[model samples]
Target chain A: MSSTLQSRWWSWGFRSAVMLYFILLIVFPILGIYGYSLSAGLAAFTENITEPLAWKAVLLTVKLAFVSTMINVLIGTMAGWVLIRYRFPGRGLLNSLVDLPFALPTAVAGLMILLLLGPQSVVGQWAEQLGFSILFHQPAIVIAMVFVTFPFVIRAVQPLLEEMDGSEEEAAYTMGATKAKTFVRVILPAMLPGIASGAMLAFSRALAEFGAVVLVAGNIPGKTLIASVYIFGEIESDNITGATAVSVVLLTFSLLILWLVNYLQSRRKGV
Target chain B: MHVEVRGLTKKFGEFPAVNDVHFSIAKGQLIGLLGPSGGGKTSILRMLAGLETPDSGDIVFHGTRVNDLPPQEREIGFVFQNYALFKHMTVQGNIAFGLEVKKWPKNRIKERVAELIELTGLSGFEKRYPHQLSGGQRQRVAFARALAPEPQLLLLDEPFAAIDAKIRQELRAWLREMIDRLGITSIFVTHDQDEAIEVADEIMIINKGNLEQKGSPWDIYKNPETPFVAGFIGESTIVEDVSTLRGFEQAADWPGTKALIRPEYVEIGQANEFRLLSATETGRVRHLHFRGSEWLVEVDVGASRLVTYRSLEKEVLHPGEEIQVLVHRAYLFNDNDSWIMENRLKEDPMPVHI
Candidate 1:
């Protein structure tokens, strides 16, 4: 090639290399799984996708994700509210503690949850006596998921809470809003987008969490087996097709969640 | 409403943002809580608004102690330094927010919001969001929002600080007229002395968390009670020695306390043989400066202090030329009251930081 053409070719070559790396790292595996899911054509798609066990896994995952997301949104809003707007003795320590989930590995987090609610810890014993089976149950999956995804909602919402002009709440108060009413009317509407976006992020993260869920959920087939654990089991049993099918369902759901969150974010930005 | 603050002190960490400040604001007066930056004007405003509580002392509104009441229960209006417009809300919605919080009737809110938009001259801008308006327009929106609900007391924290200076002067005058029309008791906090003078019925000049002086603008300018007030309110130099000019016009009547003079009152060529120990050159072409309708010319004495003179006509003088100067309006005060002296017969020789 001529020198000018050589430079053009080199730039094109670099672009191809980067594209190939993405394909190898992410897109290739996804494509492989998608192909495997569709290998049996319409028959395999119908059979694997709508299997009773597979349906249970999807249902359980959705229920856990939904409940965890709601709880996280509520508690995370309060947590973020405190972290940004209040000055307590351990304010700095509490601020750092919010980032614990991200800093702690999911496996370690799962173990900590297990230890706390595994019928051995004080809380776990009390919980069992109170007629709640926290560990080795569907609630165990939820507890594990909430633990891994707690900070997502708090971290996402806290900055937005901090960015808000505190004067609005004060204005509400000066105009005769009680503390609760001020938060409900003036503060909540403004914080809704952040909370919504954060909850969605947490939901997606919860759906993908495996290490924590596997430890807490004892992998009982019809009772405690979650989507991630289901995928692990299929892979271990050499049923790559089943693993790919389960993953495809999760991938689609997470994408839908993120898209909804992106819509909320865009609306907030437009404000 | 008449408001009295006694021994109001606010400490942020260890630094006292507002010291033991005591000032009673008369009802229906548009007063300015004037101070420089870090002088605790805003802190005092916040405390009065019930957004901040004093570590000691109490605030009494009318006859009732209000420190224990929440801000909403205080029935007071606060306009923040930048106007604090809700960016998400349109002009109409922003104005209506306060009334909505009060849970005012729908019809009343609509009528009130409309009236406010009209009063603030934002008639066609009701649909615009805060970000869509100019700085002055946002200011008007904030004003409209604060006044839409009939508050017993209105507190403005540096309301015009964000606007351009030209707009600020016009707005300051307009604000005074508006507040007077409502006959509302308003305490506006500002660091600009000129803004306070131009806008307030009475101004409370504060410094370093203490109320230095409180009086009408004329009184403050004509007779500043303290050195801080005198220095902050007007443009005049404190000379090292102005002893003989002590009672001034009352010189033969009763020799009052220590001496002082206004720069404008010190007339050049008004008298002769008034002690020319410090004499300097003044030429018709050298020493004149235009001061609006007047010219302020300087005649330097041997001691390096330029006694300033004012005249409507441009009386120019060249440098190194002869000119006679005299003191017409001079202030006499007790030595103990003054933070510093221009001259002294039995002066204590104290250090003064300008």
Candidate 2:
């Protein structure tokens, strides 16, 4: 083969390899799940999804994910800002620990939370006296989801904050702006894209959380049973169609969130 | 408003970034804090702007002591070296930020912003964000924003440091004109001596956290008080141990004296009334280069190389040729303890390693 033709052949080969990997690993599995879920016809798919228990499980999961993502956006943004802006003795250690959730197994995180906040713990006993049960309830599911998704917002926002020039904040202060106003008008807008990306990751992670949630939430059907737990219960009962149907809905929600995150990131970069 | 910085000192850990630096600016005067990088010029500017707190000092603005005041309460406008225009804000929004933060009425803000936009020649860029603007354009936006709230004092940290050379000259002239028209007490820090000379009515030269000289550009250039100012502010060849040069006065009383001779003050191929041709100093030409308008000729005087510029009208001199040069005036300073010699002599002269 001529040199140009040989190089072109290699380029096409690499391109095809990448496409094949995506097809086999991602596209094929997603398409199979959707096809299998709809194999029993649209009516059966709709009926399986409309099961009151399944609907409640999806709602609970979404509510919990939304709440936890909101919390993450606040606490994670503050954590990221503090880590990037302030100099403390253990800052380096704290910065590395932000990625602990990503490195640790979800089951281990669940057990750690269970041991720290379960009924036997001091904080858990104090909470129990206040007529609130953290374990085996909606809060437990949220706590587990938060633990597994803890790094999302912090990781997403930390680098941007680190790269951010503090001159703008200094400029604001020179313009007679209070610290609160500077953060709101100047700092927050600059961080919005990072915060949006982080919130999306937290939301998606919360939506799909299984190992941590299953251990801490106790999988009480219709009350604490999240969408992932509900799908697992369906599969255990030999209801593959129902499980796949609920998976499709959860996947769609996650896809929408991913699209939003991409949109925000692109817009920020374009601006 | 006039601003006074008295006995200002700041230390970063063991490093004294600005030590006992004191200077004051009159109302509506434009002063330039001129120095090389890490010379404490920026630190002094920051302290005056209330951005950095001094270790021990009193920053008084118009008789009011603002030492402990926060930057927001200082009523100062600061333009950062990087421009620091808000990336997410439009030109108008950036300019109007100060006014908006002060809670000015919407119509008043619009009016003020439009006026500033026109004044800064940014009429067409009102809707554009900082990233979309060029370096010069962003600089104008930063200036307009700082001026929006009508600050009592304006501080700029290397305003044109980031601009291209050609644009920097233009911006420097334009900024000086604008500041004069606004008549606000302003001080800008710059490492470029040329920029400081061209733009500032008064230039304050600092070196290694010490204030070397503070005067008008002409005065500072012509009459630098110390050897540091003479060498830093303009092109000067500092000859320590002035007794080394031939045809120099013998001063046994002051053994370690340094003489500063500016390149322009060294007359080549001519004898002035002070020194006749044979009586004047003679040095061999080491190298010569055309400096666009003049030729920069370096002549070796045995102990030191003397740098002087030859006008285009002068005859071209080659290497190894003896040239007669006359020094119109020389500034002398007591080189009591040269830092380099002291460091070489003492094993641990610097108590603080930093």
Candidate 3:
């Protein structure tokens, strides 16, 4: 009986220690930001968020994140399907390379994109000849966001494809479904949950991207300056309330998106 | 449709899953491809359904060569072992998928799906997903979905293998009756001999990627063409030498000394109860197993251990008791040949002094 009581006390101590650490590391900082955003009163918080530059930056962040999420969904779905269904030379190498973007520093990724699409590069010269510019514009911001979040959708989709039964495709074929129809009707629906959850994660990551966007977006007001860069600019200028308010907005949006992804995943498992 | 396969062969890497196997099925006949696991039964069914390509063969359906036809155009319905019902679709939606693919009218598809739901005894499960149903219900849904488009042939790869034993028996009978009513050429693969004997109109025994024999259940049971078929179809014991047994000494002259003796071919009785006492040999009882309606008695006759059944109505015999044993018939076989050999005493039952 004494030994049981000792183990119980040990478990209680361990639980409280981890809980205290989580609160001190994550919960306290987020609550502090929210509290600081409201420290100057509700009117000040509202005025700071509604400032034309701040609002425009948030809108531009959402728009570019949505665009990058769409691009990732298309490319990632194809890459996942090919990787799971086909056999080829260098397949193992290619599969391992998919996680490279996740492993590399986002700032390094931004520098690479800047170098590849800079005005002096071959791609930049070709784009200039076509009467358009890529670097230091919204397109370059989207490219950086795409690079940083490239692995999310593919990683999400690969497991779903692997878990899928091969006989399901054969059943559809025997039922008079063409290859295209089988993919659209049977395979796509099975992969939908993964795609949706991955896209949401990618969108949230893109929204908060600062290291990569700051290098190539030029940080122009009302054009390419995203919400994260704007918050950094406010912090540099000593406007703590403005930066905290914008951070609160991004935090709230990320929380909602994460909740949505969890809900979708739970529903898929339940079915 | 009348189905015929000529020289069908399938290879996986260097291993031959199916090697030069051939068979034909009459229209409306239910054929069971019975074999041990990894014996290419499923490969044959998949080839017929056009799910797997034969390395070199002709799959002729109704006198037309379909070697190049895709599964969608082959007009064959396949039921996988796990059913493979669309998990995301409701029962009604699953049953209507093939019809929709065939471009059936919307109302017609609805009507056919309703009819099949009722036919498969899933009257109120039309809106239920595959995960929400029992294994038997899932199998019925798969059957209904495969039959929705009215294909010419049906191929099932171990249709009842995934269900519980009780439900498996029920589904076997239900499948046989359903196939008979539909009058569609159907072939199902199974490793169970009893299931094949009970459900299939004809049984094709496959072994080592070869078609060993194909016949009706009664014929296959009565006359197994190959040694494998004889050993596989019924319970029997293989003895290395038959010359030591009474009245089976004539079988020693056959090319192979090995012989298969079934329980029914041996007769056991008391010393005074046997009418053919002159032709009988005294043996000691080794063991007895209770087999529901009878006692399976194992006897030690010289060096050979023989098994025979005693009716429950007869007096119980204890182990180590001496009993008169009479040999009637045995299947003598070698690696490539087999034939039944009857006891010489039964042919000429005159009192013979040994």
Candidate 4:
């Protein structure tokens, strides 16, 4: 009994210490960004934000995130559905392949894409001849972002689909409902919360992606370069104030979307 | 309505689950599918509901072959053992699902939902989710949902298995009244003999993927067609090698090959002269349990033993008492009586399981 009590105290102290360590290492840096952006004066924040080129980069970043995140959610939901509901040849291998981005380093993923579509690769020459440039363009950055976030939505919704009781559908079928109607009316409502959470995570991950965006954006001003890459350029040119302002803008947008997503999930549970 | 199952067989890989079983349920009748666990009662219900198709054979519902139809295409209502209520929907939503699936008029759906909620005694709880209710209440909601579609044949899989024993008893009577009031043809599967006896209009006893008997509760208790049905559905005592008595086969006049007697039919007084081993009841009373009015006693009669409930007027028999027991009417069965029910009076009732 005394040993059990001792172990309980040990676990409590160990968790508190580990939590404090993470708060200091991770939370402290994010706090520094927020403090520097807000406290360095509104004049600096407005002056840095008033730049048209930086504003254009922000717009491009939003568009890329929207386009890529939408495609990822749609395709990933279908992939999750098929993996959980069906048994096909090579299913295990396909499931493992979905996790390739999680294991592949961001720089290495960018390098691999550059090798495949760097104007000298097989598909790149054909695309060039067709007057459709895929490399060193905004579209190329979206493609790389998609490749990195593909597994997020699939991994999130797969367990939800598998854990579904399946009796409701059977019960619906016995009620003389067509299979299509049962899916639309009975199955989809139950899956919506899971899908939304997955989509939000994918969107946040896509917005924060910089390595792949950097390799493909080519740092073109007012054309192909994204906000993260533009921030990188401002730092390289000794403009820390402008870089901090841009970082804060991007951070606030992602945080607002995440907060909305969490609100929806908790409300769904209440229902 | 008048469902006929001919040569129904289902197999899962190398396991032969439901063999070539044959049975029929007349219209407006409630039939019991009674069996031990894994005796293929649920499998038969699934086949009848069109959720599962037999490997070979035909299931004729109202004289139409429905062997290949999916459950959605078949007009059936299934009450699951666990109720299987939608966790996301309220009681009203669950009942309205079937009407909505049929694309009924909006006002008609509302009227029907209100009627069913009232019928199932869930009017005030229509907005409550399934998890917020008791087991009995959840079962009532499932029943309401299933009957909302007004199915021709209602199928239930152990509807009372999830409720507490007391609540289950009350719900059994309510279920029978509700089903009879609607005049719906129904089939329910249960491993409980008392539940089957209490609720089913006719009982179908199944053992090891085979139909053992199909009869009323009284008939099943009075004369079981098979030994497994007899031993399983109720209590029985086996007095082996009783052919030693002179003219015992003719004088004793048992219908089948062996002599079997129910505990209630056995008397505890004088022994007959043609008795083997002095018609003895030399048993050591192992234990006595107080069961309200009567006492249930466990007696070790020789090498074999059985339980008997006897009345106590303050002259109760204690442990290690020597007494006399006699059988007035005995049943007879070998082992294969289920495979051939037409010959329930035959000399050999079943092939020995051993």
Best by DockQ: 3
- The TM-score values for the models, in the order shown, are 0.84, 0.92, 0.95, 0.89
Per-residue lDDT tens digits of candidate 4, residues A200-228? 87888888888877877677889887888
Candidate 1 on A59-171: residue-level lDDT in tens? 88888888998989989999998888888899999889888888888899888888888788888888888998788988888888888899988888887787786887777
lDDT of 1 at B131: 78
Number of the top candidate by lDDT?
A: 3
DockQ of each: 0.49, 0.70, 0.80, 0.63
lDDT of 4 by residue, B49-157 (tens): 8888789989999999999888876688999987878778999999999999899999999999999988999979999988789999999999999999888999999
Off-target runs (Cα >4 Å) in candidate 4 are A1-19, B237-261, B269-293, B335-354
Model 4, residue B190: C-alpha shift (Å):
1.3
Candidate 4 recovers a fraction of native contacts equal to: 0.80
lDDT of 2 by residue, B172-192 (tens): 989989999999999999998
Model 1, A242: alpha-carbon shift in Å?
2.5
**Comparing 1 and 2 by lDDT, which wins?**
2
Task: Report the interface RMSD that candidate 1 achieves against the true structure, in angstroms.
Answer: 1.5
A97-116: candidate 2 lDDT, tens digit per residue: 98989898888988988898
lDDT per residue for candidate 3 within A148-246, as digits (tens), equals: 998899999999999887999999999999999999999999999999999999999999999988999999989989999999999999999999989
For model 4 chain A, the run of ten residues with the poorest summed lDDT? A210-219
Q: Rank the candidates by TM-score, best first.
A: 3, 2, 4, 1
Better model by DockQ: candidate 1 vs candidate 3? 3
Looking at chain B only, the TM-scores across the models are 0.84, 0.89, 0.95, 0.85
Better of 3 and 4 by DockQ: 3
